[model samples]
Target: MLAKVLLLCCACAAALAAPGVYDAVGYAAPAYAAPAYAHAIAAPAVAHYAAPAYAAPVVKAVAAPVVHAEPIDPNPAYSFSYGVSDPHTGDQKDAAETLQNGVVHGSYSLVEPDGHLRRVTYTADKINGFNAVVERTGAAHGAAVAVAPVAKVVAPAPVAVAAPVARYTLPVAGHPWG
Candidate 1:
């Protein structure tokens, strides 16, 4: 459709530009002889196009070295420590753990919920659940004595509350929303 419209517009432009086509009313168009056909001096034919070939890149593949990891320690005695800083409040925490005779024990110090520094001592094992003891202490970098964990069972206060009613809105207008 577009090509047809373009061809039509070109033909109309050519007709308007022709000398004989621009005629005055009541006057016949001037006779202009058609152009005589003449053969053009021949041009040599264009040679066939050929693309230049490219060589493939050469790559050398290397075999990875055979790696041997260190053997696992059979003895159950080991110690480790870690420390981290609180990005927002600039608080610091340091914790360490020691495994001796298959019993695991650790201590950690951190800022308490009340913004006071506190230290926690704990012992844990697979069979027995972790038992911890917390004590208010100096801040990080302050001298603190190592305290042994005591198996103290403190009972919590019991409380009761009534059940809730009318806490939620019901579905409306045939939709599961309110």
Candidate 2:
């Protein structure tokens, strides 16, 4: 057994001392030197596409039969305002406009997503920055409202009646216990 173990150890040592697999296939150190390891990554190159320059279309003006038409007034007599409502949350926006002696008076209201309402009433003009009043009204978010408790009116207690007594005497037959 000792001789067999010694032979096995010698064989393993000889195999390990031989040349590696890469050397046997002629794949020794590369002819060109390898580059050093870099810690930082290189920035990637990107190209952005833009629309090509376009020439404006030429509009050919036509000479029509000369006709005189009424000129348009820049400023109108009446004032008007409109607003759009949000569909998903059931919120609404509203505005009203009125011309008061050439001054524009407008009132605006916006219903918020959380059921709160905001209002602004303003006298707006180019000369003066909007003179406005703002108001907000609604229950605060996540705030609970207190409810008053109702007083309980208990009905009167029912009267108790006495149970009927049964009386029937048995005829004859003496016994130790009744």
Candidate 3:
């Protein structure tokens, strides 16, 4: 009788353990007991993915230098014109003064006959600054030529003046003139 009682208890325990054994084998549990089964299983290990490697950059070829055929000018002449105006008042007062004084102020440069370059400066206050041309002749000297175009003036015809009007009046009944 004791052996039969022990066998009956073992049978009851086996019946209770059957559902958990089926769950461990991935069998679907009842909806109400799903949370308990999910908590019992171990999660899968996370994947460790890596990025792809890049190759080294390549260098491009360089182009060759260019060369010219013709010989360049060793002592070429350079010419330019510039006007001077009052910096404070923005008027060309110096130009009028230069015309009245017949003098000009400027700088010049030249290449000497012996291949040496020389520069000279001059200031002529009374000279007009109109149509002035400068030429770099050689390394020694430069020339300035003024070629202002002359303008002709025509006089207008004279107009006649009108005579003044005269006025006379009679003396009133006062003292001597009456």
Candidate that scores best on TM-score: 2
Worst window of 10 by summed lDDT in candidate 3: 92-101
Per-candidate Cα lDDT values, in order, are: 0.76, 0.74, 0.51
Cα lDDT tens digits for candidate 1, 6-120: 9999999998777544343333454445445586555445333334456899998999999999898776698999998977976779999999867799999987545568889
Model 2 regions lying over 4 Å from their true place: 1-64, 67-69, 72-75, 81-88, 141-178
Candidate 2 vs 3: which has more lDDT: 2
Task: Provide TM-scores for the models.
Answer: 0.33, 0.35, 0.17
Any idea how many clashes model 2 has? 0
Q: Order of all candidates by lDDT, from best down to worst?
A: 1, 2, 3
Return the clash pairs for model 1, or none: none
- Looking at model 1, residue 26 earns an lDDT score of 38
- Compare candidates 1 and 3 on lDDT and give the better one: 1
State model 3's lDDT.
Answer: 0.51
lDDT of 2 by residue, 1-178 (tens): 9999999999988886664534444444324434455765554343333344579999999999999888976665686888887688676898888876557888989876566789999897777867999999987565455669999999999999999999999898988796
TM-score of 2: 0.35
Task: Superpose all Cα atoms of candidate 3 onto the true structure and report the RMSD in Å to 1 decimal.
Answer: 31.9
